[model samples]
Target: MFTRCWLWIGRLLRRTLLITLSAGLASGAIGYCYYSLKFSGPVSAEEQIPATEAADSRAIIEDAIRVVEQHRSDTRVLRDAHAKAHGCVKAEVSVLSELPSNLSYGVFSQPGKTWQAWMRLSNGNAYPQFDRARDARGMAIKLLEVEGEKLLGSRSEQDFVMFNHPSFFVRDVAEYRQNFAAQANGQQVLAFLPGWDPRHWEVRHLLIALQTLSPAPETPLASTYNSIAPFKLGPIASKYRVIPSPENCPSYTPPAQNRDLPNFLRNALYQQLSIDRVDACFALQVQLQDPTHFMPIEDPSVEWDEALAPFVTVAKIRVAAQDFDSREQNLFCDNLAFNPWQALPEHRPLGGINRLRKEVYEAVNVYRHQRNQQSQTP
Candidate 1:
C-alpha cells in the first residue's frame, strides 16, 4: 500500500512541474513575438527638400539672429541681474579624450588637441532655488578649439546638449517649437502631455515603465542615446543613435535620493577612470526612407518607424575620465549647444523644427554668453 501511494505522489508532482514549465515558455514566446512585430517594419528612402522651403528656412534664421542682436543690450542687463540674484560660479576645464573622426560640421577639421571647455549642469526649470535632486539635469560642452565659417562670427564649436530619456520628446521641428513655446509660456504641465503638451507619450511611458522596473538614474544613461533630429546622409537621411556597452559596465541599482544622481555618476565615472580608463562608445544610425511614408513629421508625440530604419553602427564616441564640472566650467560652455543645423552640408538637419533651431539656438546662446561675460567684468 505504501509503494502504491508513493507512485501516485510522484505522478502528481511531475504533472505540476510540466504545466509550470509549459506556461513559462508560452509567456516568453508571446512577449518575444509582440516586440518582434512592433520594432520590425519596412524601409524606404527619404525625400529631397524643395528649393523654396530651404530658402525660407535660411531667411527665417537670419532674420531672427538680427532681431536677437538688436535686443542684445537689454538681454545683457537681464542676464547680469539673474547672475547677481543667483551666485554664479565659473570654471575652466579641458577634454581628456579624442573626438570621433566625423566630429566636424563639414569636411573642415579644426586643428588643436586641447580645448578650453566650459559646462553647466542644471534642472529643466528656471527656478533658482529649485531642488537640484528633483529636477532634470543638463550638460553642455563648448570646444574652444573649433574653427569654421562664423554663424554670426562666434568662434566656439558649442554643443549645448542634455541628458534626458534616450529618445527625444518630439520627432520634428514644428512640434519641437510648439513644445518649446509651451515650456517658455509657463505651462509646465503642458510639457508632459500630448495636445498642448509636447511630450511624446510612448517614449515617456516607456521611460516611466523602465524606471518602475529599475528605478535607477544610471539605467537610462546606460541604454541607447539618440538624436531625434532627422539628419541627412548624402541623399539618405536618418535619426542618429549612441548606444552604451552593457557588457563592460553592468547596470547597478540607483540610490533613492534624487540629488545623489549627479554625484553618483561622477563617482562611477571617476572609479572607472581610476581602474580601466573607461571608454564609452556609441554608434551612429540613419533612417533611409521618406518621412511621409513612415511617421508624421509635425508630431513630436510619436516615434519614428524603427522597423524601417534599424540602427546600424556608424561612428563611435568615447569619453574619458576627467572632472567635467569645475569652478571655471560655467553652465554656458559646459552645457554645450547641439543644434541640428550645426552639421556638415552632408548631415544637414531635416524638418521644420530643425529649421527653427538654426535661429533659436544661436539667439539663445549669444544672449546668454554675452550676459555672462558682462557680469564677469565687474
Candidate 2:
C-alpha cells in the first residue's frame, strides 16, 4: 500500500513539477513555488464539550514519538516540531480592568492582574531552515508567577500557544497518524496526497495544508496568531487569539529581499526590540462557543463561525524594549517547552488533536530534556 502511494505521488509530482516550472516563467506564483514549499484560529461561548478519545490513540501517539525521535536521530539534537526559534523575549500578560461577566474566566477572572511572561516566536518546521522559506509561524507565551496547579506539572505557570492560521490541517488521530508516518519517511507531501490509504483521501486537508504554508511574515511581532484548537474557559469553551497593535508595533521592511537575507524575520524582530527600542503590544482576545450551534470538538479542521461568536478583548500582552538575542537567552529559549496542557484545569485543551498532544508532547519534551541534560519544569 505504501509503495503504491509513493508511485502515485511520484507521478503527480512529475506532472505538476513540469507544469509548475512552465507556469513559473510567467506568473511568479509558480516561480515562488519553485523556490520552496511548506507548511489556526480557535473560539466559543457555550458549555464545555468533552472530547472523546479514539481507540487507536495510544498507537497514534507512539507513532508520533517515533517520528519525533527520527528527526532527533537525523539532526543529533532533540527539538520540537517547531524547531526553528526566531527569538524569545520578555513580556507581560495583563488582564483588562473590566471584562463582562461572560468573558471573565480563568486568567481573566481577576481583572488588572499581571503576570510576567516569556514569548517564543518560531517557525513551524521539523528542522531549522531559512526564515525566507514559506512555512507556518508560532507564538508561544508562557506566563510566570501564576497561582494555580497546572494540569501537566506542579508549576505556577500557564502556557497559551497559537499559530498564524485559523484552523489545523489534521482533523483526527487517524489523519495525525498518517501525517507522522509520512514525516517518518521524510516525505511530508505524502501526508497531503489524495490516496495515502486506498480507502481514504483528503483533498480539503491538502488545500488547507497549502494555505497553512503561506508566505512567511516580515516580523514575529507584527502578525496575528490564533489558538486553532478550542479550550476550556471555566464552565464554557473558547478560542483565543493574539492581535498585534498596529499603532504601537512598527512594520519592518528589510534592506534587502528575503533571498539575500535568509534570517530577515529574526533581524526584523531584533531591530524592533533592540535597535529601535520600540515596545510591542498585542490584544489577548477570546471567542466563546455557542451551544446552539454545531462546533465540532472532535474535528479541529472545521473552524467555528466567527460571525456567530465574536471575540472580546480580555487582556493585553506588552513587550518592553529589551535585547533577547544573546547566546544565554537564546539557549534558555531553546530549552523551554510550551504545551497547552501546561495550564490550569480551567483552561484545559479540548479535542482529539489536543488529547493526542497530551501524550505526544510529553514524550518529546521528556526525551528532549533528557537528551539536553536539563531538568524538567516543576
Highest lDDT scorer: 2
Candidate 1 lDDT, 88-181, residue by residue in tens: 1222332223434443323213323344433333333333332333434333333344565434344435333433433445544444444545
Backbone clashes, each candidate: 28, 13
**Model 2: runs farther than 4 Å from truth?**
1-55, 73-76, 193-199, 248-259
Worst 10 residues of 1 by lDDT: 79-88
Candidate 2 per-residue lDDT over residues 63-136, each given as its tens digit: 65665665674534556588888899999889999988887877788989998999999989877788877899
Consecutive 10-residue window with the lowest summed lDDT within model 2: 35-44
Misplaced by over 4 Å in model 1 are 1-163, 166-186, 190-216, 219-223, 246-271, 274-277, 290-292, 296-298, 330-332, 335-337, 374-378
